[model samples]
Target: MRAFHNTVLRFAACIAMMLLASFVPAAALAQEKTSALMTPELLEKVRRANNECFACHSEEGVKKPPRADLDITKLRPLAHDPKVFNGSNHGLMECTQCHGQGYTEFPHAADARESISACEECHAAKVLRIEKQLDASVHATRVKDKFTCSTCHDPHVDLIASTLIDPRKIVAQDNQHCLDCHDSELEFAKFAPDDEQTSTKKKRPDIDKIHEWLPNTRVHWQAVRCVECHTPATKTLSHEIVNKEKAERQCLTCHSASSSLTTRLYRHLAKEEQERLGFANSVILASSYVLGATRHPWLDRLIVGAFAAMLLGLLIHGLARIVARIVRRKKNHG
Candidate 1:
């Protein structure tokens, strides 16, 4: 019996050793595969390749997009397409946005595949941090649909549109975008807008209208831009060595009148100014207060309709008061 027990124990040990041996080769194969696909040197090559691709594609275009309204058929650098270089917008993104990955080596394009990192990537934290402070602190918390860094701020080229193109304007789109995502606006009746961004954009669509109309507006109001006031929260701004360098504010600092934000805001100017100021939160409030105003989307119709009714009521009251005065004046003259 003792001899039989020793034999059995030896057999069990052999089986365990065989199993361990089997796993070793498999693990080695896996490691070899990973090493084959990726390496520090290879990654550097990819990065360098990507930068070259972007340079010509973005700064110099071979074939300009028709929608961009810029003709570049004769443009050189056929190897580089500027659209491909303008940073990734998500390939599924759009013609203008250039699908977010920018360009990759045609053969190795798989590396640019969208991942969870795309959503939880560096930009994500940036947006969330700003919003968190916005909710708790003075920054504008309300954000619009599809609220993203790309939404209010563009990452691609160094720009602040210098022309008055409708799409470039920030007024109708900007502050309203801020109001859309703000938690306080939805939960509370109104938010006390403060942060440099929110405070700067406290007025709707464009502040230029106020400044333009003011008699001494140009001189009294220093022109401002979004970047001037809302720089990276951590990286503080300093214009001059004077007075310890006051925080930069106003559009003129970096943005000429032609900045993209200014231009986009200008387009919405043609639209009704007062209504656009009705951000998602204010729209919600309008729904609560007004009646027979909305007949469209559940929230939109209700909110917009309420505000419209109030505006209509005020117009009617003003007209009625004017008519009454006219009638009284006629009676006195007769």
Candidate 2:
């Protein structure tokens, strides 16, 4: 009997171990893979190389060209804020990994430019998904070849908004991408030029005048991303941008109790809060107070209960006053 009990316990332990091993690999595979960090020795070498590159590539350095003979018009602005890059998703990477080792020496080799990596080279999975989305976007239909990732995203300083904690910060970062093209006439004309037959010079529509119908436009701009209205309401973090005419304009779409913001702008926050607190719209309540949108069941019940108690108290006081008046009248008559 003792031997049989020990055998049963051992079998159960083996079953538990097998189940854990099966689930562990599935969980690991679900997470996105990042670039491996360099060894300490290699990291120190990369740091020294980055410092040398930054000497000429920094914001102040870009203002003064290294060679007077070089054509200024041909040189693209390579200036970037090191502090911003350090806080970005690509912060751990070595500059040479993207720019090439030839940059270590002045006057880079003719083939060094060819060595520069494309976003898709390292981010095959993510870029593949974005490519599909871009294919369906209005920009793709209008400017077939001109629209690329860098058109909206500045690789040097772009931070993943989903990783951020503050919703306002995410809104600002995402909106800046849209505003960079839509708000700037020069940028807009690159892809969305006016009809040459009608107008000699390209002119972008006034963004403020276009959005005059929206109430508190400045507040809405600060609180939500442009994509919240531009993209399909069904998609979360969608890159398929709709045209201005097709953009969402209904106030109830975002201002109602069942606001689409929960699935769109605040999707990440809602998902996080749902996992942690079991409340879907708690994120909006915690972040910003939106009228008609930030409703809580518990708070609603409390308000209704208070109103009912007040009405009941008023009715009781009226009845007591009538009974006291009758008693006084009866006593005086007797």
Candidate 3:
């Protein structure tokens, strides 16, 4: 019986040793991989591809005097700053993830099927909302060829919206996006062809001259988004932009007791009654003020009321003086 017990114990020990041996290789392999990091060859390949792609896609790459006859808008070079791109949310992702294969070589083959990724592929929900807004917008209905995501946003240079530290900078950036096409005579001419005109170029509006009615127009443009005036009042803000003529130019739209900026641009900033009203809060008022939106609500009313009272007092005093003068003349004539 003792001999049988010893044999069983030896068998159990052998099984335990076998199990320990089995785990050793996997643990060692994991350690090796962690220590080695990225292979030199792989790093070189990535660097080569980035260099090749940027050569043409970058401002430094493609020389302008782009062919007028050919639709070179897509081919035209818009410089991408590497520092900005690196700081963005999509920075770490490989270029091939969006642009896809065949971009490995320079002067991508003319016939090469460009496999660009769609925004909806990853952000289906956000894209759905934006698409609804776009479908209803004048741009989609009026223009022969509707604008795409790239028309407004450049994937390479555009920083993550949340990453923007300065509110004023964001406002300027937003306005610049509209000005990019609208202010350019070439871009405007492309949008509206002047078949009768010899130049085919349309006269672009001087933004400053057009917005003269707006106090400190250039400063306002740099502080507030164009969409604040262009988009209609809605529960959720969107890109359903209107024509400039249709835009809410009334100063009261933003300066009155019922301003839309609180609901739109300042939505996430402003806080009231324990509820975060807008993006940052009234703290942003330190940087730039939107008349009704940023100011203390009661303080605004107090100022307006005091001004009105003073005006009434002045009018009453003038009327009383005139009446006294009239009475004296009547008495004297009598």
Per-candidate clashes come to 38, 0, 9
**RMSDs, each prediction?**
26.4, 12.6, 15.8
Q: Which tens-of-lDDT digit does each residue in 218-313 have in candidate 2? A: 998989888888887665577889888888888888877788888877776666555224333667867777777776666678899999999999
Candidate with top TM-score is 2
lDDT, residue 81, model 1: 37
Clashing pairs in 3: 267-278, 268-278, 268-279, 269-278, 269-279, 269-280, 269-281, 270-278, 270-281
lDDT of each: 0.36, 0.69, 0.61
Candidate 3, residue 95: lDDT: 65
Q: Could you give candidate 3's per-residue lDDT for residues 32-63 as a string of tens digits?
A: 21113335565356446665556555555455
What TM-score do all the candidates reach, one by one? 0.26, 0.72, 0.63
Give the higher-lDDT candidate: 2 or 3. 2
Query: Residue 153: error of model 1 in Å?
Result: 2.8
TM-score of 2: 0.72
